[model samples]
Target: MKIRCIAIDDEPWALTLIEKYVKQLPQLELVATFEDAIAGSEFLRKYPVDLLFLDINMPDMNGITLASSLINKPFIVFTTAYKKFAYEGFELEAIDYLLKPFDLDRFQKAVDKVEKAMLAAKLSQKSNDASIFVWSEHQQVKVILSEIMFIESRKDYTCFHLYNKPKLLTLLPLKKTEELLPSQEFVRVHRSYIVPVKEIRKIASRKVVLQSGEELPIGRLYADNVSALVKL
Candidate 1:
């Protein structure tokens, strides 16, 4: 499994050490490193990572405080020189707490725990019923797997096109909504559109024709993602 990660520390040397250790493990992909806790927190807000290696004491905002405030929380491993903060880390449900000057072996153990937790979470999601619920027309509307034809992002909201129902205009981001659907059933062919794999009727050089005769342009960057649509 590929684990995307980021290391945040006030100390330059600490960040370097963790970066080196992360690189030693081929499974870990270091997205970015930060010396400022506030900047690191902002990065997490925009981009989601599988794991985070955080230092406790820092200027502006502390590690524990920053971790708690994150809306999309990643599996965090606290790295700090102070042992007194271990209990606080536990309260935040951190995967592991590593003391300063720890070796690569200790880092490996923490990463191992992250991998196992991620696997278990994936399995749990797969075993559950596959469906997406959205608030539309002032009510929570449950959309089944087969009812959806396609999804379009409209600035601040997402529009769900259905077979026999009116299009659902809900307050949702395309990226977040994509995460809620089964990957095999949905294909995101553009930044603004996600088509149900089964609904695709034909694919051209730059666009796709749906079974309902809807044509959506394929994004330049996301073109490769729609190759599976060709087979179906």
Candidate 2:
């Protein structure tokens, strides 16, 4: 199923970039583009959308205020230059908050998060629930997709942190751990880590901070992804 999205940004170049990215992704259909939040609101009210690529710093109406005014909300993915609003976006229940100047690959990664969530939601609705067969203490444990956060790797052993209770630890290398996790949502952006794309807070030059306020070093090998992400 395609994700119908509408791009809204005050800047012409930013809107154009979003348009270009939308055209390239087969799963994303561009329903419309609006320079102001007012026009976008009218379009959205008349026609429902699956996703919205929103700009936070619009002149007339901020993305946050626009989102708050609506009773019905589609999946929101915020785009902004400032990192200060990252926490607020997440608190507002945005699916993903992407910083400005993002590249195609990073954009793809963001879309991947949305797709994964949608797929999981559909599965839940159909009784075809999503499950992950994970290695746990010399045994395999089945985990619900919604129960996970991130895996903390410890030399040849990895601990899977779930939503409740103590985390599950298993014998697995970082590379092996990376391979086992879902590629769309889980990424090895650091050497000793695999993080959920939706869990990220912001990316500075050398490190990425999680929404939980924990910091992880941006590895040399992963620098390209970081660079590409910031460029977007």
Top model by TM-score, which number? 1
What value does the lDDT take at residue 5 in candidate 2?
Answer: 92
- As a TM-score, model 1 comes out at 0.56
Q: Write the per-residue lDDT of candidate 1 for residues 81-110, one digit (tens) a residue.
A: 999999999899999999998999999999
Report the CA-based lDDT of candidate 1 relative to the real structure: 0.90
After superposition, the stretches of candidate 2 with alpha carbons farther than 4 Å from their true spots are 128-232
User: Which candidate has the highest lDDT of all?
Assistant: 1
lDDT for 4 (candidate 1): 93
lDDT score for residue 151 of model 1: 96
Question: What TM-score goes with each of the models?
Answer: 0.56, 0.55
The digit string of per-residue lDDT tens for model 2 on 142-229 reads 8665566666788777877777758878776777767766665666777777777667789876888877777888888988766665
Error of model 1, residue 71, in angstroms:
0.5
